[model samples]
Structures are given as structure tokens and as C-alpha cells.
Target: MLRSLWEYRHFILASIRAELKGRFARSRLGGLWFLLNPLAQTLIFSIVLSQVLQARLPDTEVKAAYPIYLLSGLAAWTLFSEILNRSTTIFIEQASVIKKIAFPRLCLPVIVWGSALTGHVLLIAAILFVFLFFGHVPGWSVLALPLGITLISALAFGLGIILGVLNVFVRDIGQIVAIVLQLWFWLTPIVYPASIVPERFRWAVDLNPMAPLVRIYQDALLFGHWPQPLTLAVPALVAAGAVTFAFVLFRRASPELVDAL
Candidate 1:
């Protein structure tokens, strides 16, 4: 699948460009929408909760810590959600092309990565600028940002493709995933901190796979600290398994999946 996808790299690039263009085709702001939507959400959260939970920001030294904490974790969440949400129905979205085109199906997800990566690169840059303006440079821990982003992407794409494959057969899976993500988002510690959760209920929050990834971002981007590798080991292993399993499922189901699409 890797070799086949590489062989059809042009299609992936073209698809990514076309997808971005089509997404904001007639808008005056164009690509700015990608930056605006998430940042706008950040503004609302910043206004509502910045001071309320300012005390729970992991004892970080950064100024404007809440928004940085919020935006930093959000960057990872946005990337994961974009790929996962898109992957859920990517085939269905391109059902017409899938029916007619004889290209590799893996290219679809690759295109999703490219498009989302482009937007996220800009998002990170914007975040960095905000951090600098506030005199809260990320320092060396900033290097770990890519690792956290990659892990979250792998996890999201892994889960997404698995569902995408199933959704091709069962359209209801797509709707179910949307609801699950909403619940998952609240369960995550993005808008709030985990320290405030009661001890008895903390187990479920700890069990959430995204909890560690968000902490990885918070540690790296907001706190300027290297997350303990041991702390990340479990989710890293799970993400690897998710990717391996997704590939197996994709290979096994591609024939029927194409027909169903």
C-alpha cells in the first residue's frame, strides 16, 4: 500500500489542492477560514474560562497561559479530529470518484493529511506568534510538538479508517461517530483541566486515550517541558496497533468496500 500510494503521489497532491480550493472556493477570506474557525473557538473559551480555570494550568510559567494551553492542545485536537472526521466518510464523500477511478484508496487519507497539515502548519505558526507576543517562548520542549502531533494523527487516522471502512458498508456508522466525538471532546481535558476532577471519577478521564496526547501538547507547547517518555508509552503503543490494524482491515476489505461504495 505504501509503494502504491507513493507511485500515485501526483493524484494525492492534486486531490489535496482541489479539496482545499473547493472548500473555500468563492470566499473572500479563502484559506483564512481554516485559521479563523478554531481560533474563534479559542477566543470564546478564553473569554469564558481563562480566568475561571487559570489556577488549573498545570503550574506553568507562561503568560496568557489559558489560551496558550487551550490553543496548543487544540492544535493537536483539530488535526486529529479533521482527519478522523473526514476519514469516517471520506469514501462516501468521494463515492462518485471511487466508483469511477481505479486509484489507490489509501491516497484518499493521504490527501486528507496533506490538506489538514497545511492548515495546521499555519495554525501552529499563529499560536507561536501569539505565544511570543505574550513573552512565553516554548524553548526546547517545542521540539516534541511534532511527535505529539504525529501520534494523535496516527491514532485518529487509525480509528478513522477503521470506521471509514465500516461506514462504507453501514452508513449509520458515520452518524454514530459524530455523536461519539462530541462526547469524546467533553471527556477530554481541552476546555478544562484534569486536576479538578474528583478522585473516584478520575479513572475514566485517565482512561481516555486523548488525555495523554493533550498533556503531551500542554507539556511541550505551554509548559516547555519534555513529557516523560514512560508516560507516553501506552498511547504510543496503542496508536501503533491502531495503524497496523487499520491497514490489515483496509487490505482485507478493499474489494468489497469498493463495490459497496
Candidate 2:
């Protein structure tokens, strides 16, 4: 396993570069779109829901400036969702390379996830700049941002690989994934603070696996608080389990992928 990964390290790097170039090469704004996309969504949501529409939090913990809180959570959720959404078609879209080249098939999904993450990282920087401009300095807990994002990437990649392989044989899997992620976006606490969730329904939100990760971003960036060790522990374990399961399924499905395509 280690040898295969080591051998493909160069290919993975190249793939990441290729993905980035492919995204921005023809664009006038180029990589600036990465920051613009998320910022636009944040502004629209803030205006429609927070300002014009007058949305309110169910719990007292959330402050009047809910837009910042919501944006922080959405930033993480968007990354996770983008990875899974794009990864579904990765194997199909790259079938030519898979058939013509003799590289690690796993690199396809990895590159997709990496590119999606790159955009998210850019958005994070934008978020930080906005905070700093507003006189909000993230505390030491901001260090946890990378770890939180890593966990999100792990979960997204694992699911992506599983779905990417499945999508080769079942075209419907891609459409289903789109629907699922849309529903999942609402199920998560991206628009509201987790504290607003009633106690009984809170577990349902926590069980989402993405919830704890969103909270990690919110706490670190917005509230300048460290995520409790136990809070991260549970989600970390879940992400590990997800990766293990997805890898096993991906491997089992890989050999048949070419045949299906």
C-alpha cells in the first residue's frame, strides 16, 4: 500500500496541477473566481436571510451577526459537498486516461478532492481577511482549521471514491449523489448555529459526521474557541471508519470499472 502510494505521488501532484490549470486557464478572472464564488454565496445568503428576510436563531448562543457564523460553517460544507459532487463523475470523465495510462486509478478522485480543497483554502483566506478587517482576531484555536479541513477531506474523498467507482456501472449514482448532497446541505447547521438545535434533534445533527467538522470551523474562526477534544474524537473515528469502508468498496469495484465503462 505504501509503495503504491509513494509511486503515484508524482502523478498525484501532476494531476492536481492539471486540474487547477484546466479550471482557470481559459477564465478571465482566473483563480479569483475561487474567492468570488464563496463570497458571493455568503453575501447573498446574508442579505436574503439575515438582513432582508430577517432570519433568527432559535438559541441564544448565536449573536446578531449571524452571517459570519453561517458563512464559516458554509465554507466547510461547500468544500465537502464540492468534492463529493465532482468526484462522482471523475472515473467516467477520466476514462480515457484510465484505459490509456497505467497509473493509480485512485489518483483521479484524489485530484478532484484536492482541487476542490484548494478552492476552499482560498475561501478560508478570504474569510480570515474579512474577519481581520472587522477587528476580529481568531484565537489560538484557529490552528485547528487545518485539522478540521483534513477530516472533511478524508470523509469527502472516501465517499467520492466509493461513488466514483459505482458511478461507472450505475449512471444513476451521480444523480442520486446530487440529490443526497442537496438534502444534506439543509440537514447540516450551515445556515444556523448548532446550539439552536433542540436537544432531542441535536444528536441527529451530530450524527451527520459533517456536523462536528462544521462546528470546528465555527468555533475556531467565528468564536475563537477550541473544539473540545471529545467533539473532534467522535467525528475523527467516524471519518476513519468511512475511509476504511470506502477504500474496501473502491478496491472491490475498481477491477470491474473498466469493464463497465
Candidate 3:
């Protein structure tokens, strides 16, 4: 699959460009919509919840700490959700192309990644600018951002592709996933800090795979702290396992999947 994707790299890149262009073609703002959507969500959350949670933040020095915290974690969540959501529907969305084109099916997800990453990169730059504006520049720990992104992307894409494949056989799976993602977002502690979770419910955070990854983002981007090596353990393991499993499932299902599409 890796080699297949590589062999058709040009097609994947072109698809990515075309997908992005088509997404914003009719809109005047075009690419700015990517930055605006997430930023707007951050603004609403900051307005409604910041004062309630800001004082509870571990470090009090940074100006607009809550928004910074919110956006930092949100950057990871947005990248993740974008890929996962798109992966769930990529095959179905490109059903016509899949029927006509003889190219690698794996290229579909790669195109999803490429187009989503384009928006994510823009969001990251906006986030960094927000960090600087508030006098809270990240230190060398910022280097970990890419690793953080890699793990989150792998986990989302891996799990999402399987769900995407299953979604073909059971169309209800897509609807279920959409509802689950909404619940999953609140469960992961994006708008608030994990520390604030009630004691008895704290186990939920420990069990939640995304909890650790989001903390890595907050610590690295908002606090300028290196992620503890221990923190990467669960997400890394889960991501690796998910990817391996997804590839196996996708390979087995591809033939039937085309017919389903």
C-alpha cells in the first residue's frame, strides 16, 4: 500500500489541490475559512468558559491563558477530527472516481490527509501568532509539535479508515460515528483542563486515548514544556496498532469495497 501510494504521488497531490480548490471555490474568503472556523469556535468557548476555568490553570502567567490552552488543544483536535471525519466518507464521496479510475485506493486517504494537512498547517501558524500576541512564546519543546501531530493523525486515520470501510457495508456506521465524535470531543477535555474533572470520574481521562495527546499539545504549545516520555506511550502504541489493523482490513476489503461504492 505504501509503495502504491508512492507510485501515484502525483495523482494524490493533484487530487489534494483540486479538493481544496473545489471546497472554497464559490466562497469569497476561500482559504481564510479554514482559519476562521476553528478560531471562531475557540473564541466562543473562551468567552463562555475562560473566566470559569482560567484561574484553575496550572500556570497563571500567560495572558489569555484559557484561549491559548483552548486553541492549543483544539489544533490537535481539529487535525484529528478533520482527517477522521473525512476518512469516514472518502470512499463514498469519491465513488464515481473509484468506479472509473484504476489508481490505488489508498490514494483516497492520502488525498484526505494532504488536503486536511493544508488547512491544519494554516491553523498552526495562526495559533503560533496567537501565542506570540499574548506574550506566551513556546520554547524548544515546540519541536515536539510534529511528533504530537503525527501520533494524532495516525490514530485518527487508522481508526477512521476501518470505520470508513465498515461504513460502506453498514451505512448506519457513518451516522453512529458522527454522533460518537460529538460525545468523544466533550469526553476528551478540550474546552476544560483534565485537572478539573471530578475525582471519581478521573478514570475516564486515564482511559481516554486522546487525553494524553491533548495534554502534550497544551504543555508544549502553551507552557513551553517538553512532553514527558511516559506520556507518549499509550497514544503511540494505540496509533501503531490502529494503523496496522486498518491496513489489513483495508487490503482485505478493497475489492468488495469498490463494488459497494
Candidate lDDT (C-alpha), each: 0.85, 0.81, 0.86
What does candidate 3's lDDT look like per residue over 1-261, in tens digits?
A: 899898999988998888888999889988888778878998888877765554446656776788888888888899899999989988898899889979898888878988888888888887888777787788888898888888899999898899989988889988998899898899898888887899998988888889889888888887888888787898899999999999999999998988887
Model 3 RMSD, rounded to 1 decimal: 1.5
Q: How close is candidate 3 to the true structure, as a TM-score?
A: 0.95
In candidate 3, which residue pairs clash? Answer: none
Ranking by lDDT: 3, 1, 2
| lDDT (Cα, tens digit) per residue for candidate 1, span 1-261 | 999998999888898888888988889998777668777988889987765554446676556888888887788789889999999989899889888878898888778878988888878887888788777888898888888888898898899899999999999999999999899888888888888788998987878888888888888887778978887888898899999999999999998976797
**Residue 33 of model 2, lDDT score:** 80
Per-residue lDDT over 1-261 for candidate 2, one digit per residue giving the tens place of the 0 to 100 score:
447767888888887888789888879999888777777887888889888878766533535356667768888988898888888898899888888887768777777877888778888888888776656767898899999899999888878877887888889999999898988888788886676679988878977888889989988877778888887788788778878988898778778887788
Model 2 segments beyond 4 Å from truth? 56-64, 198-200
Candidate 2, 178: how far from true, in Å? 0.6
Off by over 4 Å in 3: 52-55
The candidate, 1 or 2, that scores higher on lDDT is: 1
Q: Against the true structure, whose lDDT is highest?
A: 3
Which of 1 and 3 is ahead in lDDT? Answer: 3
TM-score of each: 0.94, 0.91, 0.95
RMSD in angstroms between candidate 1 and the native structure over all alpha carbons: 1.7
